[model samples]
Target: MAGEITETGELYSPYVGLVYMFNLIVGTGALTMPKAFATAGWLVSLVLLVFLGFMSFVTTTFVMEAMAAANAQLRWKRMETHKEEDDDDDDSSTASDSDILTPDSYERAEKQPILSVQRRTSPNLFEITDRVEMGQMASMFFNKVGVNLFYFCIIIYLYGDLAIYASAVPFSLMQVTCSTTDNDSCGVETDAKYNDTDLCWGPLRRVDAYHIYLAIFTLLLGPFTFFDVQKTKYLQILTSLMRWIAFAIMIVLALVRIGKGHGEGHPPLADPSGLRNLLGVCVYSFMCQHSLPSLVTPVSSKRYLTRLVFLDYVLILAFYGLLSFTAIFCFRGDSLMDMYTLNFARCDVVGLAAVRLFLGLFPVFTISTNFPIIAVTLRNNWKTLFHREGGTYPWVVDRVVFPTITLVPPVLVAFCTHDLESLVGITGAYAGTGIQFVIPAFLVYHCRKDTQVTFGYGTVNKHRSPFHHTFWVGFVLLWAFSCFFFVTANIVLSETKL
Candidate 1:
């Protein structure tokens, strides 16, 4: 099956298909995962993260298979049409020559056989060529452009939400650590040696704003960047490596902060189970449902996808657990927005400087990562709207115009509110819920087949069992209702004084 050629003798690469799986998971979610755990609490958040990963894996595999089946059907239709056209052309050529038969006709036909052959072949060849070209264009538009657009929208929503929350890190840090005693009101006076540059004023605030704006701008530009996916292979590899490095650093930071007993901050005033709330927040911040889609989408070997997904989730869970425990132990009364919460609150000038530098440069990584997703969405929709091959139009409208139009509203919202909690909450309650929970459930239900059920392989489709179908239907409805409730809850929370 791997080496089999189509009737047209074209070869396909299995490797390229696998790469997409890694790309999807590692892109936007890595940056904000810590924050997710920080919001939800360890036990609940960790469980949810694991469940989310499983669901994502199942859903992605189902979708990939469904799409592959659809493409096969389309290819079959194209091939059938081509064969019919070829037969019709042969008949037409034969009929046209039948009228002039005479005693010398045999001699004339023999001498002009090459001419007749050319005549018979030319029109069919032209028709086949046209069909092939059309097929290629259609395939490119659907696979490259259409799918990419959906990805773009999902990432924009993810990154935009993350930026809002990440931008608050510096401000939140300052609130927790700054001393009011000296002329430097926003500065922290610590005995720890190192040069302290005050981030309270001057260029730092502008820097923060710059990071926030850059993040928003990147999210806006994401839909237009899909075309470059084929071109930016090396850049993507480098970025992925950088992201993994960042994740490593975050884990180390979480461990160090926790080891020093600086994890938990002030206890929650409203919840008597303050430790649990703190734990929940830390877990929520780290639990990233977004990464699951990537983990499950590409299978390098049979069963390898599932294995890797399990492994990644286990690693992620362990990281979250360690980070949360250390955080609560170390900062018992002062934990804030993320697991490395104290990096923002440390009394050492050098620590603060390092924190500021990290905070400043972090958004750049995020923006770069998110750009492709946005670009994919814009390119796909543009093709759909115009009924042409993607990137066929060479005007600003195809590139600049559409991205700008999609991005403006979100940018305005970012600027106007600039509230991290509100933004993150809204995203989690709406977009996060849909992408992580709702979509996966639907895909699983739609793709499972009856023959696969006896071996417990068909949970995704479950077509053989009406019970499974009803269960999935209810599950999807429940997810939808939850999404609506959370969205409404977020809105109310944002508006009211509760």
Candidate 2:
């Protein structure tokens, strides 16, 4: 009763901890990282991956530490309240303001500590709610009112840019397979009478505008489904598993592509401009903020959080570094969107067909996994607006909202633009900059406090440090500027078509 309980009601803290860690790493990023590598050369992308993992660890540790301190403060206050209650019991004649206070007022007094701690420690609703709120803001900005529209615009831009790259995985497979397999006539250049344009099998393509719109819609829908937390657990679990499976598939594709020597015609590392462009894209895509809430859970211990973060970063870096190097070494083209598996399939290499199948299935799995996130977001917002509890609403909304939100826009966007690379670039430039970089810095800075100690020189000794103030101030300025410059540069460059 005092601690965590297993299925048979047995206390097992370690099991609980492991479960939390599992949930933390399973998400959209796991599915998308492989695709992102297609844009930036594998080497550069790997470096960014390592960097993001490190940043994630540091930020998560800080967040956990702050949460722990807040919890301690709450416990101390509760103990004081209990002591006061005991004192009141001893003094029978003392009937205080509580006797005159209404039930609502009394309840408000009881909730004061909780509210204070929440205000002091939580930077955004996402931290408190265990959901991503920025996605909602982006969704609204882009699809709804378009007011203070810069953020939404940027997000749409980045989404489009990244989608272009993502779409190429399927396209590459089609092109490579068709071009290499049928050798009926070597060096045949004539337009044959049997050339059936209708039978021309190509990669699945989507329009840029449609991709951006779909990304925004899905982004909106993901966080909303968390409103009905109890009913959505199954959906969350399924999506998480799919994400991991997709990762596994991606890993297989990467290995096979590397073994086949695919990067025969890739751009040279000596070309600094291309390298820079690749680096910029990698940084933009990898530094995503959506995963932060998962990383910093209230239940995680500060020490464990810090250690795990470090471990996660190291693993991420190693994986990405290996992946990127192998990819670039194997891919043989200057195209930004090199689907490694597709390129390998062109050689008719062993296991290439299976790799292509996995790569093709990977995107569908991503779409499925992404749906839950979108649903959770939309559900949460609806709850906020209507002030309804989980049981109060229809189960259909809880079950269907995520899938609907996720599937709808992509279906619509399928008609607009199929360029995945441009979609991804635009999304990185626009939404990625703000959601990943700016908001967290603002929350840390705005909620920072100064430490104070009271001391009596002769009878008492107390010392205080304004550590929080200095830390937050410096961190805020540093990250804020970085976010601003990154977003600004993205917008400017994108607008000018640089």
RMSD of each: 12.4, 9.6
Q: What's model 1's lDDT at 462?
A: 13
The reply for model 2, stretches above 4 Å from the true place, is 1-3, 6-49, 73-265, 270-302, 335-347, 350-355, 382-415, 425-430, 450-480
**Compared with the true structure, what per-residue lDDT tens digits does model 2 show for residues 263-358?**
343534343223323433443434534444433433323334344545555655565555555555554444223333333332233344555455
Per-residue alpha-carbon lDDT of model 1 for 1-498, expressed as tens digits? 233443433322334434444444443333334344444444555565565455444444433333333333344346446655665766444555443332243344434432332222211211111112212222433455544443553555545553453344333334434443443222542212222244434455433543455465545554444344443557667766765565555556656765666454432223322222222232224333344323222322332433444455455546545544444344333234432432333443125565544543454554455545544543455445455555466667766765555555554555455444445545555555555545444433432331122112322221122224446546655855655674575456646965
Clashes of each: 51, 60
RMSD of 1: 12.4
- Model 1: worst 10 consecutive residues (lDDT sum): 122-131
Query: Candidate 1 — which residues are off by over 4 angstroms?
Result: 1-40, 82-231, 260-312, 319-335, 338-360, 372-376, 379-400, 437-470
Give lDDT per model, in order.
0.42, 0.41
TM values, all candidates: 0.58, 0.58
Q: What is residue 437's positional error in candidate 2, in angstroms? A: 3.3
